[model samples]
Target: MPHQQTIERKTARTTTKFTGEVTCKGGSSRGIVKDLSAAGICFQLYFDINATTGQEVSIKSDEFGHLTGVVQWYRGDKIGIRLNVSSNTSAQISSYYKYFR
Candidate 1:
């Protein structure tokens, strides 16, 4: 199948260590964000065997702020999250855009 539309403005994801949470069918889990973009994010978890693929999740970061997302993929202690919004996100995103540039 063909890929969907792009949402992120940056190709290179900036490294970020921020607290976040994931809500799945099993429940919520506290994790750390590895990096982030307007479209998606990567998590570095303490446990490797909690979440599953295709699970709907919501994540909130101190730096990136709150976002409703879904688990696109997962492997080991790392999971990929696709953000829900296409445009008009929080001020934190704009802050990231300015600081990173």
Candidate 2:
């Protein structure tokens, strides 16, 4: 399938370090949230995980509560997720970036 092209914009991607967990079809692993935005997130996993593009995932963290996302890409121990969030959650993420980043 032809992939959709994404544009560059001023979406705030706040650098962060927080413990979180990701669960997918392959399994689960602990990870650290390296960066976050209203649209997506990138995290560093603690161990090898079998996540792949378009895979559905669930993330749990103290700061953001529970979030559902789709794996956008992965390389080695790092994974990028495009979040499927509600408007309220998107606003909250933007607020966090504004106040903290």
Candidate 3:
């Protein structure tokens, strides 16, 4: 069997660990942002919550401020989000991670 690439990521991702807030459907939870990219982000919530693909979510952190995105996938306590911002905004957010790197 050959390894398959199930998801094709448009932008490169960088490892990061930061505490942030994730808001969805009137509920909010604390999550640890694990990895970030210009196009998407992956974070692990402190607790399990109801979240599904296409659900709208808002993420805020001291590093990236506020970002609006849609849930792309969720597994266990981890969730992935695809940002709704433009490339310019993505670039700005990516720049913030440089200091952490």
| lDDT by residue for model 2 (23-84), tens | 99999999999999888889899987799899999988777777889999999999999999
* Best-to-worst ranking by TM-score: 3, 2, 1
lDDT of each: 0.73, 0.86, 0.86
Q: Write the per-residue lDDT of candidate 1 for residues 1-101, one digit (tens) a residue.
A: 99999785544576788777777776677788888776778987765546777777777666656677778888887899877765546456777667653
Q: Is candidate 1 or candidate 2 better by lDDT?
A: 2
Could you tell me the lDDT of residue 25 within candidate 3?
84
What does candidate 3's lDDT look like per residue over 1-101, in tens digits? 99987977678898989999999984788989999988888989987668889999989988888888999999998999998988766666966867556
TM-score of each: 0.70, 0.81, 0.85
Instruction: List candidate 1 stretches off by more than 4 Å.
Output: 1-10, 88-91, 96-101
Q: What value does the lDDT take at residue 75 in candidate 1?
A: 84
RMSD for each model, in Å, please? 5.4, 4.7, 2.2
